[model samples]
Target: MSTALTFTTSRRPDGAVVLTATGEVDMSNAGAFATALAGARQTAADTPFVVDLTAVEYLDSAGLSVLFPHVEHLHLIANPLLAPVLTIAGLDDVTTISE
Candidate 1:
């Protein structure tokens, strides 16, 4: 079953698109996460896509997989707990990560 994962998309004053995620993100809800990212990419393909995971309680490999294809166009604002996972997955090499 899917957990309670919510995504909110907004644009920054600087024109960057940000998608904020809350709650747990696992295999069950990873597709939803991908859909949100796809929508944000469609809205502004040329601009940077920032994902804010500060409010997310948990994230699994499935959640990370959804981000792989967009790494080149993505930036991440994650909490300390998730930062290391991102780094270990080598996402930090392709995308900018902020704690």
Candidate 2:
């Protein structure tokens, strides 16, 4: 079964956008995740776009794919459990990951 995923968007005083995700991220909810990312980008086009995955319990390839396109401008905050997955996907080399 697909796990539930929740997304919240917030803007920092400096105009940076933060997209916080909770729960698992898999193919089932990847589209929603992408949509959230797109919205966050549109909200703050020139500033930092942070994806906080600290509360996420899981993330699959589909979710990773959505993140790839935004690597140039995305900053991620993940828990230790998800760190290796992101690193193995080579996301760490492109974007900042704070665990």
Candidate 3:
């Protein structure tokens, strides 16, 4: 099922930005994700980033592509369904995601 892309931000003492993404990340909301991630990057230039995708139930290549451009230390919290896709796509090693 398609899901909403809700965004919330938290700041670390060192200045890294943590944007929590809760819900499915599919074609529909991919742009929203990109926008949100972009906003975080603009605000926290040079700071590390962590996208908690544990609550995300689905993901597509477009969604993955949006993340490739920016952000370092990409952390996928716990997304079993999306993990395999990332792995097969060779993003599993490049992008860090936990199952």
Q: Which stretches in model 2 have alpha-carbon errors above 4 Å?
A: none
Tens-digit per-residue lDDT, 1-96, candidate 3: 345879898877876777888877888888899998888777667666777777777778878888887636455555676678777867666767
**RMSD in Å for all candidates:** 0.8, 1.3, 2.6
Clash pairs for candidate 1: none
Question: How does residue 59 of candidate 2 score in lDDT?
Answer: 96
Model 3: residues with Cα > 4 Å off, grouped in runs:
1-3, 71-73
> Which number leads on TM-score?
1
So what's the TM-score on candidate 3?
A: 0.78
lDDT for 32 in candidate 3 is 92
Across 35-92, the per-residue lDDT of candidate 2 in tens digits comes to 9999888787867699999999999999999999889888999999999999999998
The TM-scores, one per candidate, come to: 0.96, 0.93, 0.78
Per-candidate local distance difference test:
0.91, 0.91, 0.75
Indicate the residue-level lDDT of 74 in model 2: 86
